[model samples]
Target chain A: MTGSPRPARLMDGTALARRLTDETTAAATALHRRTGTTPCLATVLVGEDPASVTYVRMKRNRCAQAGIRSRHLALPAATSTARLVDAIGELSADPDVHGILLQHPVGPHLDERAAFEAIAPAKDVDGVTTHSFAAMGFGLPGFVSCTPGGIMRLLDEYRVELSGKHAVVVGRSAILGKPAGLLLLGRDATVTYCHSRTRDLPSLLREADVLVAAVGKPDFIRGEHLKPGAVVIDAGYNPGNTGDVHFASARERAGLITPVPGGVGPMTIAVLLAQTVRAATRQLGLD
Target chain B: MTGSPRPARLMDGTALARRLTDETTAAATALHRRTGTTPCLATVLVGEDPASVTYVRMKRNRCAQAGIRSRHLALPAATSTARLVDAIGELSADPDVHGILLQHPVGPHLDERAAFEAIAPAKDVDGVTTHSFAAMGFGLPGFVSCTPGGIMRLLDEYRVELSGKHAVVVGRSAILGKPAGLLLLGRDATVTYCHSRTRDLPSLLREADVLVAAVGKPDFIRGEHLKPGAVVIDAGYNPGNTGDVHFASARERAGLITPVPGGVGPMTIAVLLAQTVRAATRQLGLD
Candidate 1:
C-alpha cells in the first residue's frame, strides 16, 4: 500500500457547486416571480480586515449572481458589542432581509456570539448562532455553517457512504470542525474530533475513513496520518492559498481528495446563497 | 486479553455525589448568610408521567437536603406550547429563582425546545436550550446538562485522562449522548456517537477507552464490545433498574464501571443543587 503510485480521484467541488448555484439561481428567480419578494442577504462587518473584506465581497458577488440582493453594513473597528448587536437586531427585524451574514474575525474585540445571537434563527444563513448550532446537532431543519455544510454536500455529491465510517475532524472550532463532526454524526458516521490539544494526532488520524482537515496550519496533516483510500475534505485555506493537508503525498494515498482552492472554497459560498433563497422561501410561507 | 478475569473497579457515584452535595450545602448556606437570599430551583413538570413525577421529586428532595429551595410548577398535560413558554418566562424573570429545570418529555404535543428557550440561559441549570448546548460545545462558561455534567465529574474523580482517548457514546438523545460526546470532545478526547442506526456497534465499542453506555435498552453493551481496562460509565436506567451495560460481564473485563441504581442518578441531582447555589451567588452580585 505504501509504494502504490495511484493518483486519488479528485472530488470536484467547483463543478458540483456550480451546478448547485445554478439550481439556487433558478429557485431565487422563481420565488421572486411568484411572491414578488426578492431574497435579501445582509452582510455585517465590524472592521475592514483585508481578507475578511475580500471574503465578504466574494459572498456578495455570489449572492448577486444567484439573483439574491445583498446589503452591506460596514461598521467601525471600535464598535461596542451592544451596538453591533443592535445593528444585527435591526437587520433581523427588517422585512426585506431574508438572511444575515456577519463576517468572522470582527476585530477580535467584539462579542461574536452576542452579535450572532441577535440574528433571528430564521435568517441565520451563515449559521453562527446557537440556535443554528443546536438545530444542526439535533438534525433539525435549519441553516448550517457554510464550510461544514458545503463539505457534507460534496461528500454526498461523490456518493460517500458515511454510515459506520470513522470520520476524524482535525479541528474543533465552533463553526467549522465542531459542527462538521455533528453533521457527520447525524448521517450515522462515527465521528471523532481532534484539535491542538489532542495527543498523538497521527495515531487517531490513521484510523479515519473520512478525514476533514480544517486546522488553519499549512500542510499540518501529512500523508502518513491518512488511511489508504480515505475520503479527504480539506477545508483549510491558509496564507498563500495553501491547504492544511500535504496534497502531493495525500493525493496518492487518498481514494478521493479535494484540492485546496477549487475544493471547499467554492462550495461554501454556493451553500450560503442556496440557504438564503431557502430562508426567503420558508419565511415567505412559499415552501 | 479476553480470558483475563480481573474484576472492574466500581466507580462509587453514590459516595462522590454525597461529597459534592456536602460542598453544595456549605456554599448554599454561606450564600444565604452573606446575602440573605436562598438559592431556589424552579422545576416545571408539564405532565404527571409517574417517572417524571418521581424524578422531579427526587431532585427537589436533593435540593432541600443541600439547603436549596425548590419551587414546583405542575401544569396540565394538555397545556399549550405558548402557555408553557409563558410559565417558563415567569420563572425566568422571578428574582427568587436562581435555577430552572423543566422536566423532559413535556408531552409530545408541546414544543419542548420553544418552552426551554423561554428559560433564560442564566437560569437554565438543566442545560436544555441551544445556548447551553453551544456553550458546552465551545467550552464556554455555562451550566451543563446535569447527567452529562455528573459523568464528567465522575471521570475526573477517578483520574481518567480524556485526552486522545476514544470515548464512544452509545446514544444520541439531545441531553444525554449528544452533550456527553460534546463534553468529551471539549476535553480533547476522540468521541464517537453510535445509535440504533449504526451498522457496526461492537466494532466501534471495542475501540473505546471511555465507553459511555447511554442507549436506553438494557444490556445493550455486552462484555465482548468493551476494550480491556476501559472506563465504563453507564447512564442508562431501563425498567427493573438495569443499565445498558451487562454489568456482570462488563465488570470482569473493565477497569472501572458504574452500577445501575447508584451511579449517574445521584451525581445529577448534586450538580443541579451546586449550580443553583452558583447561580444564586452570581445573581446576587456576591460572586
Candidate 2:
C-alpha cells in the first residue's frame, strides 16, 4: 500500500542554525578581541550515557567552530553528590568560565537539581538553572532553555503569529515541556500542558492552533489528534531518530512540521554557542 | 424579574484562613519558645498604592496575631531603581530578616523585576524572586507565592485529588496566575493556561477537572465555562469584591467554588505568616 504524501512545509533547523552559528562566530571573535579572552563553555558530564556523550561532544564541536572555548569535565558514574556539587561550585566561582552545561541523566544517585542550582545564574548560559526558568516564566530578562529557545527562534523565523493562538505543549519536563509552555504563554499564546497523566490527549490536541510535541514518545501523536492546519513542532528524538508525532500523518494535516533529526536538535547547539558569547560579553562588559 | 437562584457552593476563605492562622500561630509559638528571636518578615513597599497599602497592613496585622514580627519599609513614590535595589539588598543580607515581601505594582516607572531580583533567594519567603519561581516550577524545595500556596493548602484541606486531573488556569500574571499553574503541574495535573487572548476558552474550561480563576476580572468565568463536578478556585478580587468566576452560576456546575473576598484572600496572609516562621526557624538553625 502506498503511503500518503507530506503536506506541510518542513521547518529546516539546519540552515537556520548554520546562519545563527555564523553570527555567533562573529560576536565571539569581537568579544575575544576586546576582552583578550575567548568565550568559554564548561560542559559537565557525570555518567557514561552514550547519548549524552554524543550530545556534549556535538556541543563542544559546535563551540570550537564558533570560535568559543570548550572545557569538558567527565566524572565517574559513581561520583558522589557532594563531589559533583563541589565540581560545579568551582565552575560557578570560576571567572574564566562564561557558561556551564551539565548533560542530564547525570546518574541514578546524584542530586541533579542541587548540582544545577550550584551553577551561578549569570553563568547559566544553557538556561538550565532554576532562576532562568522562573525568569522565562515571569517574562523577565533571563536566558532560556536551549530547545525552547530554539523553538521560539523558529517561530520568529516563520513569522507565526503567537499573540492570540492556542498553543498546546505536550510534556512537562523542566528543560523542555514546562519551559516551552511558559515561553508560549509569555508570547501571549494561551498554553495548555499535557503530560503522561493527561486524560484524552487527542481531544486537547484537536483544540490547539499550535502543537508542540516534546514527550519523547515516537509516533505518539497521530494525524487524527491534530487540528487542521495547526503548526506542528516535533521536538521528540527517539531511537532511529523518529519524532513524537507520526510525521507522515501529522504533516498531511499540519501547516508546518519540523523533522526529528534536523529540526530541534541542531538549534540546541547553535543557541548554546550564541548564549556563551552573550555571557562573555556581558561579564567582560564589552557590550 | 427574579434573578436565577444562587447555585454555587461558597468556598469560604475567611473561615478557612482563620483556621489556618490558628494553626500557624501554634506553630509560631512553638518555634518562638524553642528560639528566642520571633519569626520576622520585612515588608517593603515603594509608594503608597492604596491597594498595596491595604494588603501590607493586612499582612502585618496577621503577623502580629500569629506571633510573627513585622518590619515595615515605606519608600517614596519616586524611589530610584538603584536605591530600591540597595534597600532590598540590605534586607536580604540581614540575618534577622528571615523573609522579605516587596509589594508589587511599585510605581509604573520603576523596574519591578530588578527590584525583585535583589531579594536573596533564602529570604524570598514570599516567592516573588526569580529563584523562588524556578524552584517552585522545578518541583524543588522553595516557598511559593502566598496566594498560590494558600490555594494549594485549601485544596489539601478539602481533600481534592489533583493527580491525573486536567486543571485549567485562567490567567498568566507573574505572581498569581503563572505560579498557580506551575504548582498544579507539579502535582501531576495536566494544566492549561487560558487568558484574554485565548480563543475558544470556553472549550478549554469545559475540559477542566479543576478550574482556577486569577484573571482579576469580575465574573469572567461563568457557569457555562465550568465542567460538572469541577473544583473552582477564584483568586480574583475586583473593586466590588467580585471574583473572576461567577460564583453563583459556578456553584451549580462546580463541585466546589471559592468565594470572592473571603476565599483566597485570607489564605494569602496565612501562608505568608507560616512561611515567615518557617524561614526564621531555618535561619536560626532551630528547625
True contacts kept of each: 0.62, 0.88
Model 2 stretches with alpha carbons more than 4 Å out: A1-6, B1-6
Residue pairs that clash (backbone atoms under 3 angstroms), model 1: none
Q: What is the TM-score of chain A alone in each candidate?
A: 0.98, 0.97
User: What is the C-alpha local distance difference test score of candidate 2?
Assistant: 0.88
| Residue-by-residue lDDT tens digits, candidate 2, A54-110 | 989988988999999999999999999999999999998999999999999788798
Model 1: residues with Cα > 4 Å off, grouped in runs: A2-6, A34-36, A80-83, A222-224, A283-287, B2-6, B80-83
> For each candidate, what TM-score against the reference?
0.91, 0.95
- What is the Cα-based TM-score of model 2? 0.95
lDDT of each: 0.91, 0.88
